[model samples]
Target: MASDLKVHSFEEVAKHNKTKDCWLIISGQVYNVTSFMDDHPGGDEVLLAATGKDATNDFEDVGHSDSAREMMEKYLIGEIDGSTVPQKRAYIPPQKAPYNPDKTSEFVIRILQFLVPLLILGLAFAVRHYTKKE
Candidate 1:
């Protein structure tokens, strides 16, 4: 890491939020994306929506292409001071009872899974029979 690279607090990064001065933090790196807004393939609103905040999840969720990743390099301005980066809470999915095939809903869905296809096939056959030449 270059010692000269600017380090900004989250508050400092947040100060640049505007159409003409947008900045965002992603994975603790700060970027001034104001110039890139008009050129963003997703449109300026998408970029603007993430301005002044940590957009790491939103950015990663889009699954940006390698070229897009490369493009971001040009806008790199600094990194967020490690101490200032907000710690995100870990998500824990709610526990549920183990799946039971014997459940009525599951039994009904299994029955429908089998019968719906059979019914569709039967309907197709009946339609064909009725439409056949005399």
Candidate 2:
């Protein structure tokens, strides 16, 4: 770290976000990328969208080349106050609810399918028996 590198709070860095005045924080380093917006292969929108938050993941996810990494030096303005940036949340698997056979619609449908045909046959037999001559 250069002794000349100034430190900026997250809130302070966030306010510079705009097409003509954008800034980004990646890996705790603050960069003034306003001038580089038009030249960015990803376009200004990509850089603009990265503002107002820690963009380390966004930056790393792209797998920037060594030349791209070297190019970042020209845009480097300062270092961000790490304490103010939000930490990335760890992945937590969702809890699975136990399967309840009694609550399933498939169970009700199966019961109805079996009973409906039996009920129709019983009704038809009852009608035939009642209508027969004594």
Q: Pick the candidate with the highest lDDT.
A: 2
Residue 31 in model 2: lDDT: 97
Tens-place lDDT digits, model 2, residues 1-134? 66799999999999999998999999989999999999999999999889999999899999999999999999999999989887779999999999987779888999999999999999999999999998
Estimate, for each residue in 14-118, the C-alpha lDDT of model 1 and write its tens digit: 888888999988887898999987888899899889976689999999999998898888888888987876677899999998987679788899999999999
Clashes of 1: 0
What is the RMSD of candidate 2? 4.9
Where does candidate 1 stray beyond 4 Å? 87-134
In order of appearance, the predictions have TM-scores of 0.62, 0.66
